[model samples]
Target: MGLAGLRIVLVEPAGPINVGSIARAMKNFGLQQLVLVNPQCDRLSVEALRMAVHAKEILESAVIVATLPEALQGCVRAVATTARVRDWEAPLENPRTALPWLIEQPTQPAALIFGREDRGLSNEELNYAQRFIRIPTSESYASLNLATAVAICCYELAQYAESPEIQTPQETELAPLELVESYYQQLESLLLNIGYLYPHTAASRMEKFRQIYNRTHLQTKEVTMLLGILRQVEWALKTPRKDEKL
Candidate 1:
């Protein structure tokens, strides 16, 4: 289980040294793909080049994109890194809980997203991902440097990749992120339509739903059951009738 096709996306990285160091870390962990979105500094600057050292090939092959969605195209699973604890974001999971799924599922390539060093990922950007990761640290200084965060997550991922006991059974197919996302989208819309969630508090309420389902680690059959439940609820809400009270 090599990190052959996994993609690491850095959104709006402003520090060239951090970028280069991230490349070096990726090389250390055997990751190849590096994507940058709207980088503020020259990724190939002399400073970056010097820091990359032996990982210049990763730097040279890095794909630059204009936006986050464009950078995440073709990725089946995406995990966003964040330092702040937001009530509306999915529950922050560690790399240990998250990385296993990536290595276990070989067919779908996973993407790890690191936000800007200063502000971290925006609310909208966080919504684009199904899950969020938080590095456990002292509360006084919870935020970690971009390169350090990358190194920690990559190291955890590499450890899982090297271990053989973490292998997943072939019969228990993991549901694709797209399918799970669609279910969440439909669930949220239906809940909003039915008055269970209001516009003012919709995001936070929906985040609870995300956390519950993600914790389940839903399989294909489980997802089908959930979709069926949502469909029934939606149909009940949509079906209108004349005033014929029983």
Candidate 2:
């Protein structure tokens, strides 16, 4: 979706220096949207503004939210960064290989999600993303500072933005993450109603469902069809038979 539609989401970022540097990197790369989830540090603090330098406006204009899902409101595609290999089958690709996918939608909004400076993303947080990016570093010194990591990813995004291949349109379009999320909520409630998913196991079972849907690269219309079916089922469940006693 090019740089304009790309969002940089930081989850629980605790350092003003890191937050400011990330804002600067975003500006240097032409990206405009920034969403912070429950940040511990004051993003507008003097230290942050000093680090931001000429990109101070980015720091000032960032959207702050209480949760990751709120940060990702209307996004259609997202790539979450993690330091360790996760348990899920989703491949942890390098930024060069994966970041481009976030911008391929051209007209839609996409996101690059970063976790807290200390622990990276929890597995539950990682599930929100369809793709994952792991910057390759030496095994002896694998840790990259949060700001440095953001700089590397922003550079890769900028590189991909300039690629000739990215300008062409793809055959299929991804549904907005909001729409897909509605489908998930509906599917989960239905599964619960039918006893296919108990509250105790629903979260884990739904994770498997997420992996399947993410792998299929489901398109907008396909998700719409699924949502329609869910709506119909909900209607039937709520409707009463004429012969039934009041």
Instruction: Report the number of the highest-TM-score candidate.
Output: 2
lDDT digits (tens) for residues 88-194 of candidate 2: 67788989999888877678788999999889998888878898889999999999999999999999989988877666566467787877888888899999997
Report, for all candidates in order, the number of backbone clashes: 0, 2
Clashing pairs for model 2 are: 1-103, 1-106
Please write out the lDDT profile of model 1 over residues 1-246, one tens digit for every residue. Answer: 348788899999999999999999999998999999999999999999999999999999999999987887766567888888786635788878976666566666678899999999998677657678888999787778999999998899889888867656574555666677788889888888878899999987877777677666677778889999999887876676567454
Q: Rate the local accuracy (lDDT) of all candidates.
A: 0.83, 0.88
Q: State TM-scores per candidate.
A: 0.77, 0.91
Cα error, residue 92 of model 1, in Å, equals: 4.3
Q: Which ten residues in a row have the lowest lDDT in candidate 2?
A: 164-173
The residue-level lDDT of candidate 1 at 244 comes to 48
